[model samples]
Each structure stands twice: as structure tokens, then as C-alpha cells.
Target: MRHIVIRNLGPLAEADVFLNKINIIVGPQSAGKSCLLKTACFCNWVEKRIQLSQDTDAFKENGVFENKFLEFHKLYGYVKEDSYIEYENDSMKFSYSWKTKVFDFSWKEEGRWNYVCPKISYIPAERNIVAAIPNWFEVSMKNDNIRNFMKDWQEARSVMTEDMPILNLGVSYRYDKSNNMDKVTVGDGVVLDFTNTSSGLQSLIPLLVHLEFLYTKRFNTEQSKNILRIEEEGTLISIIWNYAKNKSHGEFNIEKVYSNFTEMKRTEVFLEEPEQNLFPPTQGVLAYRLMDWARGEKGGFLFVATHSPYMVTSFLEKDNENDISLFFNKESKDGRYVVSTATEKEVQELYDYSIDLFHNLESLG
Candidate 1:
């Protein structure tokens, strides 16, 4: 399990959450659910770069750090004077301070967690936009998060061998490589272009496709190298050259360092609003599938930020409830948003609240 503590960051006044095999954060709008997930994703990305020997210089260059880390994720504006964070997994510990704009990392060299690198992907809320526009790359966009997701969606399409059923919702998604477009198959062989699919299909297909692609290519060294950003190639070459120099002096093995760069043993995906445009029953099914996906492989992990109570309640219905960790981001008595462990009682309260609102609507008539 991974643990994180955050304070005074964006709408999150304070939060302490554990990242388990299946972690879900539910909260109201602007309550900082996305902020917390993005923070964790950024820290994990930094940890991977540090493992590749790319951190020493960036730590000194705060501007580079901000541009690459915060700005890339569109989280630059979330920092406050009192903002602070600490994240620790089995192998790495990371902390950051907003006042100094500094990041500190501690790597455990001798442990089971050592050399355990995860390929992290952030599926943004705008993923449906990519599905709607096949040639999205042609359009210029400032949001790196969505642009990166579009790239992933494109790559995922290349690897699709057959149509994918969307949660058994009586529709299947497929990619037409030759035509360079997406297609959906409905009952009785009716075919619809992906652009013409329902809002729910559009929203869910990108996420599922990306997950399938990553799962298929897990532990693939070439695939891992292919995904590396072009700017990071300089650091990658530098690390290899330094290793070669050390090898000449009998200090280290160059082959081992090279292996570290190529081998990615895990896949950690941070999903924003996974339940978007999904029905309650389908959301329940998706939640179970996500759990199975994370627990099926040794190093697979999922971190989801959602507003749907169905997604959270599904875990309670499962026998392996202990495997999932639920966090609720809500306003405290002081009117600051805080994250706390989600309980069955709280889920019931959500239902009660919804019922009350529905009653209020009925009374209005």
C-alpha cells in the first residue's frame, strides 16, 4: 500500500489516504478529488524519473520542475503558501514544500520494492473528446494531460485486434486502422461510427481501450521505451553513458542500468471521473472489473476519482472488500475539504441525500 498526506493544496485543505490495490475517491464538485489524484500521479512520475537518474538537476532548477511536473499536469495554480505533501510507498518516499518550491525524495535501495517501476497513465476527464475526434492531434491544445491521453488512445487503437464489448452493454467498440477511425457494433450487426456513439460509449471507450492496451503490453521493454518522452531521451542517454564510464572503472555494470530503463514491471493508472456518463448498474460492473484488473497482476494498481456512489457501493457488495480502499472528500465543520475513510454508513447517507433531493423535486410539482 502507498500512503500520502496533503495540506493546503487547491480545494483540499487536508487529506491522508492510502493507495491500495483499488482506491476510489468520491467527492462533490471542486472538492479537490482530482487535485489529490493528480498530486499522487505527479509524485509517482517524479519517483520514476529519479530512479532513472534524472532528478539531481531538476531539484536545483525549480522552474524546470514546475514546468515539467506542475504545469504539465495543469496543477501549477493549485499550490498555496502553506501547501505541503508527503508520499511513501514501500520503495520510495517523496515530500514537497510549496513555500520553497522544493522536492525531496528517498529511495530504498535494498528491498522488494527496489527496481519496481510502474508505468503511470492519467486518464483525464476530457478523454471523450479524443474519442469524438480521431484527428485530435492536428488541433493545438495547451492542456498536456488531454494531449497525452489522446496519444495513448491513438496507440491503443493500433493494438486492437478485435472489437471490445463495453461492459456487456450490448455494444462493441472497434478501430478501423485503414480508415483511421473508430466504429461501434450494435445488436443485429448494425454498425455506427464511434463519433455517432452514445455519450456513455464515448466516455467509457477511451479508458477501456487504454487499459487494454497497457495490459496487453505489460512487461514489454520495447513498448516501455517507446512511451518515453523525447525530452527524457537526453537523460536516458546520459544515464547510460555514466554507467558505461563506471563499467570501465569496474564500478558498476552498464547492462544493469540499461535494463532498469527498459523494464517496467507495473502499470498504475490514475483515472478521473471513471463513472462519467455511466448508468448505475454499469458503474457497479465497471468497479468490479477495475478491481479484478488491478489485482490480477502483481504490480497493477488503480487510483480512481469519481462522484458516483454506485462505484463505491460496489466494493461493499464484493467479498474482497478489504482489497479496496475508499476515501471521501467532503467539507468539514470548518468548511474546509478533507479526505477521510469512507464507510457504509456514509454511502447510505449519499443515497438518503439523493432521495431527499428527489422528494424536494416532487414537492415542487
Candidate 2:
């Protein structure tokens, strides 16, 4: 299990969360739902950087850490003088404070550090723009989240060999590599340009494409090991050399490190607004699909920040055997947001809110 504690960060006053395999955060706009998820993403990135460098002083300069982790996510502005964060998992522990400007990290055990480097992907809420304009990354966009998503979107499109179905939607998305175009195939043989598709699909396609691509690429143990071996050749060499030196000193078992590095990789995805431009039924289906991906034989972690009641309800109402946590964020009396586990009463509140919205719309008719 993983745990996170945040305080005085952005719109969030306090958030203490014990993360599960599948975690969902739901709240009104500006209630710190996305902030919580982004904070987690930043913490994970920090962990990865420290592991790769094998140095706690990897981010010796606070400016370097802020720019790479906080500024990249446009979260620097949210940091107050007293902002503080701490994250811990099976492998390592990380803590940082804005007031003190101190970053503290430690491995769980003496020598048995979990060497699995996660393959992480962040899907932004603005992903529809990536689908609408596949070349958007070429434009001058300062948002790192969307830009990163576009890169993955392009790669996913290039690798897709056949049409991929849209859940609960009677359409399949196809990419024409030769023509460098995207098309949507309807029920018969009719195909239309992707840009001419519905808004719902325009948003859903990018999310699904990247989700499927990353999962397939990361969950395949043999394939992922080979790819990582090639890409992290230098890092692996350094790690092995250090392990061998430590073994000669009778420090620890080198074989255990190699075993962990080779076999323990997991995929982590931070998805924003997964119910974007989707209908209620389609949102439910999407939730189910996402849950399945996290609960697959090859385990993965999914963290979603969403506003849709349908999306939250779908996940909450599922017959889940795996660990799943639903967090609800709301404004407290002190004008700060607090996040806590969703209770049955909170779930009913969401249902009532949805019904009130529908009734308000009915009055116009």
C-alpha cells in the first residue's frame, strides 16, 4: 500500500490518503481534486528520479526540483510558504516542505530496495485538443501535461494496426498511417474523418488510445523488459556495478536486486476527467473498462480525478474484489478543501445533486 499526506498546497488544506490499486477522486471545480492527483504524480516522478540517480541529493537544488516537478505541472504557484508533502510506498519514502525547502527520502529496508521503475503516463483533461489537432504539439503550448499526452497519442496512433472499438459507442477508430490521417468507422462500412466525429468521441478516443497503448506496452513482461534493457542500459550498468561492489563487501545479495529490477515493473496512470464529453452510459462503461485494466492479471495502478457523478458512482457501485478507494473533496468551514473517503451519505449527496441538476434542466423545457 502507498500513503500520502499533503497540507496547505494550492486549494487543499489537508489530504491524508491511503492509496489502493484503483483510486478515484471526485469533487467540485477548484476543490483540489486535480491538485491531489498532480501532487501524487509529482511525488512518483521524484521517486523515479532518485532511484535512477541512486542519490538522495539528486535534486540538491530546490530550484531544480521545483522546475522539473512542480513547474512542469504548473503547480509552483499553488505552493505556499507552509506547504508540505510526504509519500511512502513499499520501496521508498519521500517528504518535502516549502517552508524549510527540505527534501527527505529513505529506502524501506536496509538493502532490499524495490527496484521496479514504474512506467507512468498522465492523461490531461485537455486531451480532446490532441485528438482534434494531432499536430498540436508542434504549436507553442506551454502546458507540459497536454504536450506529453500528444507525444503518446502520436506514438499510439502510429503503432495501431487495426481499428480500436469505443466502449458503449457504435464506432471504431482507425488511423491511416500512410495518409497520416485518422478516421472513424461506423456500423456498416461508412468511414468519416476523425475531426468530423462527435465531441464525445473526440474526447474519448485520445484517452482510450493512450490507455490501451501504455497498458499493452507495459504489462507485457518480456516485451517491456527488453525495451527497458535497451533504454536504461547505462543506468542498469551503474546499478549492477554498485551491487557487485556491495556484494564483495558482503553488504547484500546482488541477485535479489536484479530479480526485482527485471520482474517488478508496474504501470501507473494519472487520468484527469475521464468522463469528459461522455454520456452517462458511456461514462459507466469507461469506468468499468478502467477498473478492468487496473485489476488485470498483470497489476497496475490507476488514479483518476473527475467531476462526473456517473463516473464516480460506476466505480463505487462495482462488485470489486480488489482494493479500491473513493475520495471526496469539499470545502471546509475554514474555506479550505479537505479530502476524505466517500461514505454512503456522501454518495447519496452526489445522487441528489445529479437529480437536482436534471430537474433544473427540466424546468427550461
Candidate 3:
């Protein structure tokens, strides 16, 4: 398990999140749940970059460090020196000071926790927008999360085989590129046009394929190349992940691997509102499937920010209570944001609230 603590970061006045194999964050809108997840993502991204640089001089000599810090500052807006982030495990500590931009990383007995950086990803609430994309053309978006979503969507579409796990979804949609335009087929019918698919599926495909992309990466293999090249668009974290996986395997010719690559990444994904547009049963399926992926062969970390009680209670009901950590984000009477562990009874009513709405997704959701 790992621990993350944040002070004076965005709407998260003071927040602490513990990460187990599977971690969940639930709260009302504008309660700073997304803020906490994003902040943790940024810090985890940076730490892995540091680890990458430490393990390989090519990464350091190439100026990836300065580039990453400047990029993070521009993208995340590290407000002040007063705000800080601290991450730790039993044997190691990773700390950063936003005001001064200093990092301190230490391990009690060297080489104990020099683990590969988990592949990091986030599924934004706006994922459905990618399905709106036309067959041959790409959509333009300024938001980082949205851009990453589309990039992952395009990559997943380009590589997926007919037997991909996403095909198991109740209504699996496959991207057909041989058609006049990029087309999608749901079941045996004419769902080739994404506009014709249900909003629920449009939202689910990216999440499905993205996980497929990540879980397939085998960092332990003897591959000729390490990194998986993606469009230059999207988060630096993805870039860092590509670089780290490459470095972990042994040094490689950057220019040659730059254009070609193999494998999935070993990293974490921060999922926002995974329950979006999903029915209760599918919501439960998505929740359990993500956990299975997190603890699967690839084995990266998983963090979820949600409003659905089904996403919460389903895991509890699945008898994974001991392996997961749950946090409830809420604002107090005085406007201070507080995060507390959720109890089973507390989330039961919340699950009931969400389950009731599933039958009425047309009017609800």
C-alpha cells in the first residue's frame, strides 16, 4: 500500500488518500474529488520520472527532467511553495515542495522499492465525445484529459483484434477501418456509425480499449524495444511511461524505437466517473472488471472517482472489502473539504440511490 497527502492544492484544502490494490473516492459534485485524483496523478507521474532518470543516464542526459518539470508547471499550475505533496510506503518516502519545486526521495535499504512506474491513465467524464469522431478525421480538443481519451481511443482502434476482451461487454462495438469511413459494429447489425450506438457504449469503449492497451504491456519480457509510441498529443505522464518502460528493459537507440514499439505499460490509471451512462448491472461489471484488470497480469495501480454507489457497494459485495480502501469526500458546514473512510452502511443507501436510477437512465443519468 501507498499513501498520498496534499495540502493547499486546488479545492483540496487538505486531503489524504491511501492507495491499496484498488482505491475508490466518492463524493458530491464540486467536492474536489477530481482535484485529489489529478493531484495524485501528477505527483505519481513525477516520482516515476525521477526513478527513470536515476536508473538510466540516457533519460537524464536527454534533458527529460527539466522538460518534465516545466511541462508539469505549465499544465498543472503549481500554485505556491506553501503547497506540498508527500508520498510514502513502509520503506521509502517521496516528497515535493511546490513553492520551491524541490523533491526528496529516499529508501531505507536501497533497491527495495525501485519498482517500475505504473502506467498512468485517466478516463475523463467527456469520453463519449471521442465516439463523435468521424471515420477518417480527428476532433480537436484543448482539455488534456479529453485529448488523452481520444489518443487512447485511436490507438486502441488501430490495434485491437476481433477477440479483444471488450467484446465481452453486453453490446460490444468493434471499430471497422476497412469501411468507407471508420465504422463501428454492435452485435451482428448496422451500428457501424458511432452516432447509432447507445450513449452508454460510446462511453464504455474507450475505457475498455484503454485498459486493453495497458494490460497487454509486459515489462518483464525480452522485447527489442521498451516504449509504446503514441501521438505527441495528451499527457506528459504517458510520455514518461513510454520512456520508463524502455529504460527499465535496458538502454535502446532512441531514434529507432521512436517510430516503432511493442507491449502494454505497467502503470496506474485514475478513472473519473466510470459509472457514467452505465446501467446498474453494467456499472457493477465495469467496477469489477477494472479491479480485475488492476490486479491482473499487468498489475498497475487503479484509482477511481465516482458518484455511483453501485461502483462502491459492488466491490464490497464481491468480498473484496479487505483489499480495498474507500474514501468519502465531502464539504463541511464551514467550507473545508474533508475526506473520510466510508463505512458499508453509509454507502449502502448511496448504492440504493444509484441502483434505483438505473432503470430510468433515459430520464436519469
Candidate 4:
């Protein structure tokens, strides 16, 4: 998918950075890279196609009827004090056009308006995995709709015990005897804890679970449409159970393929700076693995807003085409910020500089 254009965005007076599958937004601090990612997240929220919602009371109490509003608002830099959003779509060609109006404090003065929203996930630069992990979990939980929609899983709950060590280690929800209610855990050696894991583990756990749940949910739902009973020989449950149980160690590791979605996920995962807590080597590894998974898993797209040259170089080394789009924001004479793209040669040069800097740092160590 291509960005096509973005107008009247934060500090971005008017800029257009066309996008590809693996698009990269690189720029100095406060260059509107995060702004672009937010715009894509907002678009995805509004589109309603990607089901990311919450089943919590805070959402209902706020009168936030849909999850899109919440997800759209999570993106910083968009003038949220008072804003109006509008957009259009052309499904035949799989393209969209969107506009959001950011009103100033007075509501009368126009802050900024952005056009073009894509199905993007924006991982911020600072990483802030601790704070971000919960939000990701919320999104994943809502999308999985496991709590509300997956009746089979709900029924199977009785057959399964919440006491399992692995179940407690992974992120999930459980019931409390004292309150007779459910609680979410973050895999910290039982005790229904979410704080013991490292920030990296916490952040990645939700993403992994979400992907697994999404594929599982879709496969079950679709298979049920075609099959009737639980046949011992060839049934949906057996198929998914075998598939999930047989997943391998690699990045894209499913033993048996159930549906087309499994073939090519094509999900546009937006990450701001995935290398927040990771060292240079680990950073490159994570970025490479995630991108490779997207390409191989049919999980189509990945849009990243990053300052780490190591991550960008990792993508470049993979020999993917214009898949990585670069953006740089410049201030105009009038004190306005404008976003622009870096040429292929410019990006490569920047990568080289980053590599040299990292190598020098390594030498110092």
C-alpha cells in the first residue's frame, strides 16, 4: 500500500510520502515521523475492517461506542483538543483517502488536517514497552474477541485449567476466587502478575499472542462455515489443534496450513522504534525477523517510524525493493515543518553512516 499523500499534519504543513510494503520513516527528532504513523493507525481504526476493540468498562463509560475512536486517539501529535475526521475509500483498487482536522485551543483556529490513512501500526521510537504493552494487550484481546465471541474456547475453558504454569507464564486473563472475576496477567511466573517480565518480553508477548489468536480465530470461523461435526478423521478443531501444537521455532512457524490467511498474512505492522531497549545486534535481529515474518506469513505490510539506522540497514540488506520508504522533515522559511522523502542514494548513505557509527561504538567497547 502507498501513502499517496498527507496534508495539514502536525508540523507537517503539507507533505506526501508514497509508501510500499515495508516503508520506513526516518528523520530527526520531532520530524513528524510519529505523526505519520499515528495517521495510519487512525485510518486503520476508522476503517473498521481490522477489528481492534476493547471490552472494558472504561471504554463504555466514556461513551466511546467503537474501538476505532480509542485507537485513533492513541496516536500522539494529532491535534486532539478538538478534531474532525473524514475519509473516502476505493476498495476495488484497495486504496483510501482520509482527512482529519485538528482544531486549536480556541476551536475556531484550524490546527492541522492530514489526508491519507493506511492500515499501519506505529511503534514509537522511545519503545516505552512497559507503558505500551498494556495497550497492545487491550487491542489484541479485543480483536481476538475470544472473551466474547469464541464460544468453543469459552466452553473448553472448563476442560482446561488456569493453574498450568505455561498458561500463567503467558499473557492471559483468569478468574479471582475472592472477587469471582477475571484478571489479566503478564507472564511473570504465576501469582497473576504482569510486572516481572522485561519490557521487551512484555511488549512482544502481546504481539505474538495476538497473531496466534487472530489466525486461530479466522481459521476456526471459516472452517466451521464449510464443515458440520467434529469428525475424528478430518475436523476443524483437529486441524487447528494440530496446527497450533506443531508450530516450529522459526519466525513464521506454523506446521499445518489451514486457510488462505495462513498462507499470506499481509498485516501492516507499524512500529516507531522497535529497538528501544535492544542493543544494536538484537535490534537488527528483531527488525529483520519481524519483516521476514511479514513477507513470508502473508502478513503483507509493515510500516516503521524509526531513528535507528541499524534497523533500516537490516531491511536494506534483505534486498527488498522500494519496500523501505524514508522521510525527512524540514522547516520552511516560515517556521513550518514539511515532510519529504529521502532518495534511494541518500537513504543508503545514511545507513552507511549509521553502520560506521555503530562500528565505532563497538570498537570503543
Clashes of each: 0, 0, 8, 14
For 51-170, candidate 3 gives per-residue lDDT tens digits of 443333333344343345334333355344587778776546676666655566676444333354455677778777767655423455454666766776676666554534343563
Question: In model 2, which regions exceed 4 Å deviation?
Answer: 110-112, 217-256, 259-264, 343-365
Order of models, best TM-score first: 2, 1, 3, 4
| Cα deviation of 86, candidate 2, in Å | 1.1
For each candidate in the order shown, give its overall lDDT on alpha carbons: 0.74, 0.76, 0.62, 0.46
List clashing residue pairs in candidate 3: 81-99, 118-267, 118-268, 119-266, 119-267, 119-268, 135-182, 217-264
**Sliding window of 10 residues with minimal summed lDDT for model 4:** 104-113
**Could you give the C-alpha RMSD of every candidate to the true structure, in order shown?**
5.6, 5.0, 8.5, 13.9
TM-score of 2: 0.85
Maximum-TM-score candidate: 2
Error of 1 at 36 (Å): 0.6
What C-alpha lDDT, on a 0 to 100 scale, does residue 244 get in candidate 2?
Answer: 74
Off by over 4 Å in 1: 109-113, 217-221, 224-261, 319-321, 343-365
Candidate closer to the true structure by TM-score (higher is better), 1 or 3: 1
Please give the lDDT score at residue 12 for candidate 4.
62
Candidate 3 residue spans exceeding 4 A from truth: 55-81, 90-92, 110-114, 135-143, 163-170, 179-182, 217-265, 343-365
Alpha-carbon lDDT of model 1: 0.74
- TM-score of candidate 3 on Cα atoms, chains taken together: 0.72
Q: Write the per-residue lDDT of candidate 4 for residues 122-173, one digit (tens) a residue.
A: 3433333323333433443333222222232232222222532222235463
